[model samples]
Target chain A: MMSARKIIETIDIRKIYGMGEVSVAALDGVSIDIEEGEFVAIMGPSGSGKSTLMHILGCLSRPTSGQYLLDGEDVSRLNKVELAAIRNRKLGFIFQSYNLLTRTTALRNVTLPMVYDRTKEFTPEESDEKASRILEHVGLGERAHHQPHELSGGQQQRVAIARALVNDPVLLIADEPTGNLDSQSGEEIMTLLHRLHQEGATIVMVTHDSEISAHTQRTIHLLDGRVETVVKNGKKKPGKEKVEK
Target chain B: MKPIEAIRIAWEAIAKNKIRSFLTMLGIIIGVAAVIIMVGISAGTEAAIQEQITSLGSNLVFVQSSFTRGRPGQGPQSGGLVFDDSTAIQDEVEGVTAVVVEQYSSETVRVGDVTLEEVEILGTTTGFPSVRDIDIAEGRYFYDLEIERKQKVAVLGSSLAKELFNNESPIGKYITVGSTKLTVIGVLKEKGMVGNTDYDSRVYLPISVVFQKFTPSFFARIMGDSVRMIYVELDEDANLDSVITQIELLLAKRHGVSLEEADFTVTTQQDIIETQESTTAAFRSLLAWVAGVSLIVGGIGIMNIMLVSVTERTREIGIRQAVGATPNDIRIQFLTEALLLSIVGGLIGIVLGVGGAYIFSAFSGMRTVIMVHSILLAFGSAAIVGAFFGYYPANQAAQLDPIDALRYE
Candidate 1:
């Protein structure tokens, strides 16, 4: 494959909790890179710092010390306001709980991101129309006006995905997107993610289930706040290109 | 986020909890209402008193005798205002148009078979009609020539006529006061109550008639027809201050005393109105301070509820932050909710206050005047209170850690 542009690159990132002697390192000198259009999964047991790494990568939190570059621009030292702008313009997130605003209709939930979009790419009417179209594309055309409480777990997750995709983000981070759904619904969600990947959307997922991680092109396994192995399709990748300590 | 979007979000949040929101706004509602109503009643009373003073006459000055010199053990000094003072004011004072010497006594009056006790018997000259703004509904006022001859002619006020004669004409009828027979020469037009002075309840007579019938000849020789008060009318272009000074100097000379030792007090209509207005203004401010306390308590109510709302919606705030909302967006959203609550409450208060004023007047017979500025002031203060009290909770919500908020379940 031709060399791809790096969408995310973390250089020796470290995140410490508390201070002094009792300080705990959640991520210890970890470094990684994700190319454009890559489908990757982060796998780790509880207390392994996978959640902390997801937060840092999502721009929801900053590392204690490190260089994080998104689309080749340093974002590690940016303040909360600048980080929020980057998140609004370039990144999207889906939480494990499908955190849609309660009592809001599905279409409104999908249109929320555009409300904060500073580009003014679409008028309010156009935003509603686009949100409707996306809801149709997600196989919930008739349920656009239904609130989250009225929808099933699978449908709620689909609405969340529609919300995340509304801003045309460069990176989509899903933290166990199907964790709250039943097996059949989880299978459907996996199928939808695969279809999105085929359509050239870069996706990152954090999950504990091996079966869930198996669907990704590459999986990074973490242990004891460090990367334990990098596997490709059940086979180990050749070299650890950027892993430190 | 756009302001419109924040407003919409705030509306939804408030609409979700209708009872609590209304209960929260009750403080503002009562506070604004109190402010409007209290100001309305006080201003109305002031207006009524002002109208009462002005209605007595145009450019009028009142001179009433006051005891300025009296020993601790001895009887009061004999220097007092006499009926001659009115003639001196009319002749000597510049800009003086008319001077009316008046006195009153509570006496039993009998017309035909009807006798009314404690009826006010007023004695004055022919200028009483012009200077006091009184009009004759029928017949005519006692003529000035009648005062020289001490004629036993009288004018009946409209209400006194109604009490004595019912539907019969009181004109040319006989009314007896203190066993002295008098003919009713005129009946006054119906002039309603001005402050506590009811113009339509007194019996008017020529000044000499009252002095001849009520006072002993020896006392008259010494006191020279001593009167109760003098009402002086000035022309339209009169300078009240200079005219008042002239009257003061003239009275001092007539009483054989200096200006400081003068036994009479001179006052214009404006002075009376001003004294009443100052009193009402103090009362208005006292009511405003009381209303302000309730408004402050209302603001605290909003703050308390907003703090609770922020705590309750911690996870919702987290969701908003995850969706790219800045701290300011959250702050604006919550602040807008508080502002909307107060604005709506203020609107309701304005309506209720105005309506309540009218209703209170209708039931209690107290005059109430609603001023436009009071409503605006109440509404403006409500908005300010909402914003002032809303900031802390909104800031607390904005300062919340997004990750920890999300984990708050």
Candidate 2:
């Protein structure tokens, strides 16, 4: 019987920036394993390479030298078209800037990924319906027709999240998802990510705040293009807490 | 994305900036309208020229006497072939139908109560009306007997009659030509002006009467009753070249010279018509070229506006790109917007151009005609210009870097 795992492993991943004399290593010899249905957060300061590791894991960028097996398939050496396909099918991205089309409505923003996924056959009406439902799930159902400029920053970020989830991706990768929001809006977005994780969706988020990382079941700390440590929270095994303590 | 969604997005973008879109389309409108109007004017002028040429009778040929050199110090010297050359043509040419002789001189005339100013007086034979394709509106034309007897009879052109008799009929009344009193036998129908010359304001009489009464000394001193020119009518089935050759031979034999020194130039009316058509065709092509330049300028204007629009929407392009839109989508969107602008402008321009042509024709009394083929050409060229000029800007928009564009304010 096969194990139902959303991700397999990463081995000796290295990413270098620039070339020749001015080269800088953004990620060096980084490796980690993430299992199915886990909410993990990567914490690091500026220039610590957490964003570079997240980009490699999300298939947004390629590793200079590494092995990354996503669902037991080697994804490190994939070509551009194959990487795009993997990004479309398995990875969903939530940006810190909330890059929604300015003049377009929330529903249209949500339906954009489905437009790029040409192999999936859905009529325009069905796509719109699915976009509307996802917007509703993100708590922007009534604001489906509102343009990005008309919505608040937090509401716009939620719309971006809805757009990412509309493809039903297996791994949700967010980079500084709530960095630009107020405390209340940031907490709300984290709660939304927590709820999505509880529904058996695998999530990997990058942030600089320890308090934000505390909401996840596991935290990975990185320093100077290397992973410092990985810590599992006590809640992962509530029944064995007394024995372990 | 579905085509309908792209169209909707384009329309929304256009609606957002209505004034800018309209301003961009104005160039196309003016270009198309200018093309239609210029072509209409040329067509009108060509039609007018053809109508005038046709009215002069296409089958009639003119034979004018040529003069050899006389001394420069000689006063009022005259040398030309005589009326016998006309008779020779009639007798020798197989295609000859009717030959008429003409002598024209400006002379003062008088009636009962009014002494008219100097006007053109044509002296011709009884076959003048048939050869020139003119009709007598009232009374009868002079017969051959009248020409042979040297009777003083005249036919008044419609305007000449109006000038001499007012509203009263002038047939049978006498009008003085130089010193001879001639009786009016008929009134010619009204003929409009051609090439700014008034043909209806003239009088006609027999060549015999004019030679006997007005210029007796001049005619007697010349070879044999010489006149200005002779007009010949040919059978419709006869070859014009053969007839011309035979007439040239007869004229050369009669004038005692070779074909080159025959002292006459014979020209068919078809030659005049052909010359006029080519001249008008040249003018029409010139007008079309001027209009084409305007259309090119309009195309450049579309390109300028599209470049501006692409620059203005760089951030929007970046946002779309970030949301997984391919470069193709960006290209198609901008191209569709430009196409819609030009097509709508072209349609409006066509309507205005046709309306302008009709209005010009009605108000200015110029015959303006709009051809269907010209309209199609204008419309098709406008679309091609739209595509050609809109392509570069749209490609520029499509090739923009998403990362750099997002950084643009």
Candidate 3:
């Protein structure tokens, strides 16, 4: 563990809701470390603060107290614009609802992240080319022009995954990425995540399913705003499919 | 984000809600159209007045013979300018080019069993043609020789000729005025209207004949050869103020009185035109303000609908923020939508406004002039209205918190 390069570090972080007498602490006195290129799953009950921790790690919220360091830089005090910049350039997010813009073609939806990255200059044609390539990588090259409603549930999630990977982000944060999918689609998404993990991608997924937890390299379980246990699982078989790059 | 990308996003949103977008722009459309039409009418009134004045005469200085209110009983010793004063001004004034005396009488005119009663018969010297810019459509205007010879000849305005002759040539024809038969030698072309004077519907005769035929019946013969008004034309390079002062002093000296007691009012055409223009300008601004109120109301409508749109798209805004859009970016996107709506509406309003002005002129028989400044003002105001009214709603959208907006029901 000492030889591994740390990518995310939290020192007794806490997030409190409300103020004075009627306050509730969503995350309290929690500390964890995630190393580079590691796939980890966060598990907890409904009110156990796993989602709060994910919000903090993804730079969507600032901790109420203590420190959060990402890639060896303190991010707890960053401003909204700075946080947005980090999110655009370094973090990718996938939501349970597969939040792709309605009425937009798959290729255009995937190109949106690059359009918001102000630091990089991309012409419309260049963004279009890059988006199409990413779409092809996700096996949706034929569905590039299809709108969100035209695609099936599994196909829409695949488009969302392509959007998440368009910016080549450093960390992929997924919250119940397969929650709305059919069982067969869910297995395909899990297999896709496992495949990316073996290719040296850093991933953090939040889910309560133990069956999903078995696919990750390590798991962190939370109980009542604090870390309960950390476990290593190697039960799932490796995916034999190779990516075409 | 780049501005073009923001515009594209705004266009997409507007295209998705085509009916709502058109409804939002309708207010601006009506406002802009009203503004243009008002301006057109105002400008046309000014042009019509200027044309009417110029048609009466060029550089005309009018000396009106207002009878003095003498002390009751004293026989009112000829307290008005007589026809000799017209010759005096023509001879003595330095910049004076010509002077013509005008007197009028209403009489029934008869030509071949068709009679027009109470028709105006104007009297003037042959200077009428060059000084008044009136053209002869048929034969030549009667000149100095005709007037000096006291010839029983008359020139009919083209419309008068049409009424009496029914399209038959009026030149070399005879028309009787009050049982005094006269030959129509020439006809004036269509000169339209000047103030209440319809130049085309009137008849013209020499001052000698008008005085002999009408002035002998004057009240108790107290006014002998006294003309009602005198029109003086000046050289093109002459200063109007100087000419007016010279005539005032000359008339005072000739009548054996001081300038104030001269019993005549001398005025330049410029003074009359200025008075007309000032009145028209005030009316124009009043109409413009009334029209501008509609534009402001339109702006308020835009703001109202924009607020509703922001509320409806709260989740969409939340998703954009989560995907890394800044507050400024959100503001620009919504602002772009509003600006596009107003600009497009303004353009449509311009076309409608100009067309409306044409229709008004055609139906009402009044001229309408569309000035370029009015169009630009209407367009520029619409853009400002969109941007100004759009600010609050766009700010509301930008200030939204990602967490609350994303979780909103």
Candidate 4:
């Protein structure tokens, strides 16, 4: 049994890609639950629907049929506008490609999430202070005014991470966050994620590399649109077991 | 997102491709400029004509023969108004002030040994000074008795007197005109050309002298006693239209023709002004239609470029959405870009338009008046074009599925 506090819960989620003659099941009958303050990595081969699951968890998409409880609310059937509001307030996303606006300064990119955060309604000055703080936290304080092309790939990804954290979201979802980085930069990013996790931030990362997944507290592996196994790296609580699948 | 933030984003996009953006705005610039210049020149012409009409003496109307519109060769040959028609209008029509009749001929007049051939001789009555507004700079005009007695008296216009006597006062002196000697009674004041005809270059005489004495006997036998034109001035409280109707009815009855078939045309100063104004207005409207088409073309140009921009920025859009931007935010950003382009273009066009109007007036000597209303109208329509045309592409950008957009290569 896991902890009483389940931060994310999905009941028998099914996602279909086409219909009838050419139908393909992207994620078929998968269920998962996560606890607060957890660092987990989802791993799978290319056709195994790991990305589709990550998209659903990030509130970027919805499953064809499911019951998803994010912070204990059924959000699977929420409209796109409602999902976008939730994403702005509660979820932060880091994509594989950095995805920073090319012509904008790094500080502006960091402040972008706050621009759409209607619930918090941070004024420009307040948002600027928060963005600068996050940029310094990501170790790119001096590069705040530099455009994306002026920075290296690693620096751009650092800026993206700062943007994701600027809103103080509950769930930090990173989809192949270090996928495009050099080995040295990738290790450095993993160290940063580990540091964030130590500070009690809930993080869900998607990675196919076993060596990378080994650094997480738990590794959930998928095969043929189903959870193959859940590997624990030996930080077990009482009455809780690994490999729930 | 706030509008200023959206405007900043749009500015970045525009600055990325400056040349392309300017080219997209070219049509609007030309359209606005053409509209302003056209209206300016036409309005200026109307003002100038109105001034000329006011100078043509107060409450004046003109009567002339429309000989070309008469049945073929009948008008100039025999079918036209005579001096008797002026008398009839004066007698039969109410609110008559004075009717000045004119008869013109080219004749040789000798003051001394110098013989000036082709001196234009105008035969008019004593009402010439009052009705035609010609002042007597020296002596007096020929009176009614002089006209009735066919007296050989003449009034020299200021320029004609200068040419004939050269510093010598010719009043009360005898000048031989077409084999008949006439006493020069007055030196008329200067009146410059109203159009191509120089009103200051003619010599005035009594109508009886020009009709019964100056013209050859052969001309009298063929053309009979004919009058060239009649200038009529009205009383202060006269109803002009009613007087015109009375004159038309009396003339048609005397000439044995209906009003439709009458060879003479009566026109007031206002009538001539309206005809000229409508012509200029028609030309202006044509130019406006062309300018309007150009503006539409400019709007289409904006839509085309924006659609291309939307395609190019698909990845950017997806990234924005992932960072919690709503579709409305993306739409506003693109729309702002289009509005900026059009408004900036309109402003430049205003500068060009006013400059062009002044330059045209300077080079062509044609008048041009630029009104504030035209500027506002051009700019307002340009903004409307921006908003209207920008909607579709902005909506296309907004309605893109985030997942699919993100996956776009």
Highest TM-score among the candidates is held by which one? 1
Per-candidate TM-score, first chain only?
0.93, 0.92, 0.93, 0.93
10 residues in a row with least lDDT, candidate 3 chain B:
B69-78
Please give the DockQ score of every candidate, comma-separated: 0.61, 0.27, 0.54, 0.58
Error of 3 at A150 (Å): 1.6
What pairs collide in candidate 2? none
* CA error at residue B324 for candidate 2, angstroms: 2.9
Stretches of candidate 2 off by over 4 Å are A1-4, A7-19, A23-36, A40-93, A173-175, A204-214, A217-245, B2-5, B63-85, B101-124, B144-167, B172-184, B193-198, B201-230, B250-265
lDDT, candidate 2, B335-355, per-residue tens = 877777787778888998899
Ranking by DockQ: 1, 4, 3, 2
Scored against the true structure, residue A212 in model 1 reaches a CA lDDT of: 88
Q: Tell me the interface RMSD of every candidate, in Å.
A: 0.9, 3.2, 1.0, 1.1
Instruction: After superposing candidate 3 on the true structure, give the runs of residues whose Cα lies further than 4 Å from its correct spot.
Output: A1-3, A231-245, B65-94, B105-107, B139-153, B178-181, B208-220, B223-228, B235-239, B249-264, B351-370
Q: What is the lDDT of residue B330 in candidate 3?
A: 86
TM-score comparison, 1 vs 2, better candidate: 1
Candidate 4 C-alpha RMSD relative to the actual structure: 4.8
lDDT of 2: 0.81
Residue A232 deviation, candidate 4, in Å? 1.7
| Model 1: residue A53 alpha-carbon error in angstroms | 1.0
Higher-ranked by DockQ: 1 or 4: 1
Residue-level lDDT of model 3, residues A74-182, one tens digit each, is 8999988888777788788887788888888999889988878988999899999999998887789999999999998888988888888888887888888889999
